[model samples]
Target: MAIRNMTVATRSLDADMTVDEFKEWLRRFDTDRDGRISREELRRAMRAIRARFTGWRSRQGISYADADGDGYIDDSEVDGLIEFAQKNLGLKIVAY
Candidate 1:
């Protein structure tokens, strides 16, 4: 996927991303296709949004969203990640 054009495709994800849309976008970074998001994947996602301090933020995001202490954000923990993205990454997400 072209990371540079992702923002344009999603309108920078500032307009508002539905829960499904957010998950779809995030999944693009799951390089391993493990149906889970790791710190590195999260960092890449952060970079896609042009966020600063990606390393730190990715660590923090994993810490915040890894509810099961699995070191990865799985499906059930996605809500926490969504919250982290909205609050810390300045992304607007809407549940509809």
Candidate 2:
């Protein structure tokens, strides 16, 4: 996927965004392009969203999402991250 210049602070996630769109947006912070989100990448994402305590939040996110204990949010565990984003980060993501 082509990485856009849009940052979460500049182009906030829309409440109506579909799950795929949300994933695409989140991927922007996947700096290594490893097809997985790391704790540091998630910290950057949280920072872009103006979230406080980004380090703590990122750790919590990874803890919640990394169901395989692999230390990364891979495709299979993305849903858990999405739930964390919604409940903790106040992001609105839809399944449709």
TM-score of each prediction: 0.87, 0.86
What are the per-residue Cα lDDT tens digits for candidate 1 across 1-96? 212334523457456667887888888899999999999999988887778999999999999999889899999999999999888888888877
Q: List the residue pairs that clash in candidate 2.
A: none
For model 1, state the Cα shift of residue 95 in Å: 1.0
Q: Write the per-residue lDDT of candidate 2 for residues 1-96, one digit (tens) a residue.
A: 322455567656444556887788789899999999999999998888788999999999999999999899999999999999989988777766
The CA lDDT of each predicted structure is: 0.84, 0.84
lDDT of 2 at 47: 88
Q: Distance (Å) between predicted and true CA of 21, model 2?
A: 1.2
TM-score of 1: 0.87
